[model samples]
Structure formats: C-alpha cells, structure tokens
Target: MQKQREVGNRVFVTGIGLISALGNNVAENHSSLAAGKDGITKAVHFESLYTETLPFGEVKLSNDELKALLHLENEFGYTRTCLLAVKAFEEAVNDSGLSAEELSSFDTALISASTVGGMCLTDQLYDDANMKFEGSEYLEAYGCAAHTMRLIEKYKINGFTDTINTACSSSANAIMMGARLIKAGRAKRVIVGGVDALAKYTVNGFNALKILSEFPCKPFDENRDGLNLGEAGAYLVLESEEVSVGKRKYAEIAGFGNSNDAHHPSAMSDDAVGAIISMKTAIESAGIDATKIDYINTHGTGTPNNDRVELFGISQIFEKVPPFSSTKSYTGHTLGASGAVEAIFSILSIQYSEIYPSLHIETNMEGFDAAPITEFQSDVSVNYVLSNSFGFGGNCTSLVIGRVN
Candidate 1:
C-alpha cells in the first residue's frame, strides 16, 4: 500500500532538525537567536594546540546521551561527530509527518555534506595506546562515508546515501543536488544537509592558518579577528510536490550557483571574481531584481581578507546592498555544517516573519565600508535571502531562497 505518489518534482522542506553550539533543537536555537545571544565559548572537549588560545561553539551532550538517542546496544565506538548526526537525524525524522515506513513507500535519498568527519574518533586512535586506549575497535566506520551509511541503515532508507566534501560549501551544495534529484524525478523525498563535530584536526588547521580566534568572532568589524570553531548537525526533509500534499512547507529554494576561484588553495581571490559570478548566477536563475532581495546570510567567517573581498563583491553586485547578518556569531563556524545550518536560519526568518542580527560586527572593515545588521528587526517582509559560503581552495557558492508563493 503506497502512502504517497510522485508527480511533479518540486521540493519542499517539511521538517528541520538542528543541534549547534547555541542550542540542541529548534526551540532552544530560536530562543538564543531571538535574545541576540552568542554560543562561542571555551573548548570543553579534546586537547588542542589552540585550546586556551581559541574559542568554539561546542554542544553540551555527553557520549551517554548521544548513545541513548540511537538506542545502540552495548558500548559504542562512534565519534562525537557521528553522535551529533544521530541526534539531529532522529529529530528530523520524528518531526517530519512521514514515518520511516511511509517514507519507504517511494524513492528516498539521504545526501549529506561533511568535512573532517568523525574527527574526534580519528584523533583518539592516534593518541597514546597506553592512555585509555580501546584499540580503535570500530575505527573504520567513523569517516564521512561510514558515518552517513550508519544513519541510512539506522533509518532503513532504501535510497542513495552519499557524502559531499566541497569544503565549507559542502551542505549548501547538498541542497543544490537535492533540487537536481527532484527536477529529474529521481526521488519523491530526500534528506539533505550536513554534520560536523569539533576536532583537533580542524582547530589545529585553523590555528596553523592563524585564523582561529581566542575571543568571540566579529564578522565585518574593523578589529575583527578570525572565526571560532563549532560542532553541529542539521537536516532538512525535502518532499516532492506530489508527496508534500498535506505537509507544511518552508521557504522555496529558487536558485543556486557554485564556482571556484582557481587562484589560491587556501585563500579567496582578492578580486572576489568567483563570489561575484556565483551571486550573479543564482539571482539570474531566480529571475528577480537585485534590489528585491531583503536580506543576506553572509559566509562572513570574521576573517580579515574574507571580509574585504566579500564586501567588495557585494558592492560590485548592486548599487545598494540589502539588510544582512552573519549567524556565525551565534553558532561559530560549523564548517561543512555551517551552510545548511545557516540555510535553516534563513528559512526560519521567513517562517517567523523576523530577522536575526549579525552579532559581532561593531565597525566596518577598513577597505570595505559595507554595513551589517547588528540588531534584530521584525515585521520586515523578506522576499529573498542570499546565503553565501566560501571555503578553502577558493570554493564559493551562493543560494537565493525566495518567497515566490
């Protein structure tokens, strides 16, 4: 007995689950964002080269609580990253109107984005064998691919389970892939988003890059430093039009664009050529006015060079930029998880009929005189929001979330 049928391939997000540094689930996260609060704080897990020298958005869930969510038997070998994913995935599936069995009625896919997957577990494997060593019993399944597979089996989804590792733009790109699947009539329902747990590899990598901040991150401030790392996993349930008949829909994803600078492996081009092209393509695909956009969720990592180039790129696009904010101050840099986490935040703004501020931008960066919304505003109708994500290797992506309904 099939519960739903696939007709038109239009995709709508009926369910969302997120656990970040700010809060564990939707209610908690919404409260934190509403109060203009920040989640960046001291590192509570793992030793790091920049432990005391840097801050991060670490979730407060212990391994025991994480294990309970998955109802795993006996002791577990999963890493902190996998645990976070399990928690968020459970919430997403539970919130969606479709039950696991009902979702199995049609082609369902679980496509996720990740970077430094299962990092905490990998770190433990390399630690001193004599110091509480468990011999890495299940070390093989902790990476990105295996972690995703674990979720697919747990949920009994009979569709594709894959990982996208496009650096920071991974999950945002996941949505683009999901849209393609729907347009091609590949699946009636899909789960798309990203997950990442804080790890020594990421902290040390950022420290080596000299972009890890000790205090809170300031996106476009003149005294802005670097970003604070964080841990999170968020998911979106995308149901095709035919399957979404009775479900509440979120904002529509109108257009998306991705491009690589090809200039520097670790740095974005000074001219922001790639970013500009990506924004242009996304807006063009949406077939909307540049000035019609009401908000922007910037990939503002609070780094020096990144701010300059991003602001320059925005100014180049329109004569006047729209009200913008960076939710990173509230969630830290969730890395691969950032794109999807921020995407949900953008959609929330539309659903709640409000706008969240970019927390730490106090002053404009020197060369870029662009403005940032530092205070929360409401009743401002948001027709479209531009969410940007740019990462190492010059990878950049832009998505235009619109209210064409």
Candidate 2:
C-alpha cells in the first residue's frame, strides 16, 4: 500500500446526480451496475435513420416524455440537452440540501459541459436557416455552451459560470475547475458535470468517423470494432471541507491532471503519451505511488484505436495494472458527458466498496496482457479510483477520487 498524503484543505464530493441509459438517477444506475446489466442496445428514443442499423446507449425517454417529467410549460424553449442537464442538476441540488437562496448566492458557482447542445434538432435548425420569415426557437440554444447557459439562468446562479468543449474530457475539466475554485476560495460551493443528448447530428458525425459499431461494443476486446454513442447527464456537488461539515460526503477530489498530446484531431498517438502523462500527473498530485491505485475507470471507447492505445498507456503507468473496466460498456461513449458520468461511477465504487464490470469481452485484446474485470466485484474495499477521459485532438484528463475518512 502507498502512504496517503496529508493535506491542508480538501475538496469533498457532497452530492451526485446522474441520468443515463442505465437509469434515471444514481440509485437506479447503481442497481443496474450491480446486476452487470448493460443499458446499451438498439436505439428507442433516438431518431436517426440508422436507428435499426447501429446500436446506441440511448435514454429510454423521448423529448416529450422528458418535458412531461420536468413539468415545463407547453411553449417552453428548453432543448433536449438543457432538459437533461436541468434534471441532473436539480437532483444534485436537492441531494445537497441547498435552498433556492443558497443556490443563487454569490459564493456558489456552476460549471456544466456539453457537446451536442441544441443540435439535437438539426432538422429544425436547417429548415429555420432556409426560411427567411420566422426564426427557429432553438436559434439562441445552438452552441456548445447553450446547455450550461440555460442552467445558469434557470437556477439564477450568480457566481462564476463557464462551459467546456474538450470533446470527451469536457466534464472532467468541469469537475477539476470546480475543485480549484473551492480550493482557491473563489467559491464555497460548485456544481459541476456535463450533459449530451443523442441527436442526428452527433450520430451522423460519429458514423462519418467510421467508429460506430453495428452491435453492442466490446471494450478492450480483440475484436472490438467501434463504440456505441450514448446520451446522459451527470453532475457532482463539491464543497470545501469547512462548508461540507455534516453533509453526506461521498469522496474526496484528491488529484486531477489534464494534458493534450496535440497529435491528431480524431485519434491518439500509438503510445498514448497524453493518457500516460494524465494518469501519472493525477497520481503524483494525489501524493501516492502509481501502484497505490486500487482500480481504474478506463476511457475505453471500444474503438480499435482507442482500446489499444489506452491499454498501452495503462501498461506504461503501472508495472501491474489494477483491476479496471470501462463503464462505457454499459452507457456507451457519452462524448462530452463521459467524464462526469464516469466520475459518478468512480465515486460509487468508493461508497459501495465495489467495482463494476466492463460488459462483453469475447476475446482478450491482442498484445495486451491485462484484461478488464468482466464481472461485477463486491466487498472489494476500493479506496482510490483513477478515472480517465481522453477526447478528440488528443485532449486527456484523469481524476483521482479517494474514499473520505
């Protein structure tokens, strides 16, 4: 075991909120994970023409269903992306026991991330563009930052607010930024995470990349072809040690690292230099040895390139790699929301002392000696979980989440 580091001030994960294909909230998601049940399958809620051809990790609810659940007025302009974000954010705020006044305080900050934003309505956007008379209701909500901006205004959050667009690493950076704000005394509390709704735009984009799997993805498997796109929203409430007193703290933000390989726009280098640096930096920042990590939440997207390169990075970081798996097997690759969604899973691993499994490995990956945990593990006593998120343009990030004593 590695000696744990002593620190002056600590950031604590006080609350978590998540909605994915796996479940509607944290409890539901945990149940599904414990059963080793995968939520990925043929798309039911997504509206792509490839709906029957390509598998997806799609939320079961439709836009109208989500609106009904959220109880919005008929004429409300909330896009599907914003609706998903508000659902998770509301749950996180309620879980943290924050009142309306507390939410709007100047000391409270909000950091949310998303890539699809309002592009879920691509058809409507195109039609509106061609029409000269009336503009679409989604015109203002059609950017990468639209979801976060809507959330900010919805909750009347008055403190610092920002949006990130580093592809898959967006929400990990959001959580990291939230921790820094608290540590630097810039805010007493911060709500950070990400959301991405399945859209024709995103589906077609990934299809064009030739990385969309026809069947359920097999992450880290030799025959892994590509990834299944997923949609989800996840958020975590981080409070300084002083403010977190008497709260239901889940874990500590022990360490985080961000790096960009700058190697390619769509693929990582063979050695995964950015990924290796990210994990190493995170471990160093956590004041622990590389071997001390108990498990890893790998950024295994199941694509031929991603799985191999990520495994290479893991081999470089640990002489004997820890028991790790890609939860994306269950939720699929959630793009911008992956980091925050997987972070919640990491915190759950600590809280429950269990490690969830990576679904469907027909054969071991070639040239890789280590394999993902294929079955759910219980009573494992996980203390440290290193969650990795690497995105397009070689942007990589890792977060070290530790059990709170």
Best-matching candidate per TM-score: 2
Model 2 misplaced stretches (Cα beyond 4 Å): 1-8
Report lDDT per candidate. Answer: 0.80, 0.90
Among all windows of 10 consecutive residues in model 2, the one with the lowest summed lDDT is 1-10
Q: Write the per-residue lDDT of candidate 2 for residues 1-405, one digit (tens) a residue.
A: 564654546899988899999999999999999999988888887777999899888888888888888777574668888888988998888998988998899999999888787887888878877885488678888788888888888789999999988999999999988988888888999999999998899899999999999988989999999999999999999999988999999999999999999999999999899999998888988888887799999999999988899999999989999999999999989988999999999999999999998888989987878999998889997999999999999999999999988
Clash totals for all models, in order? 0, 0
Model 1, runs deviating above 4 Å: 1-8, 73-75, 127-134
| C-alpha lDDT of residue 244 in model 1 | 81
Residue pairs in candidate 2 whose N, alpha carbon or C atoms collide under 3 angstroms: none
Q: CA lDDT of 95 in candidate 1?
A: 82
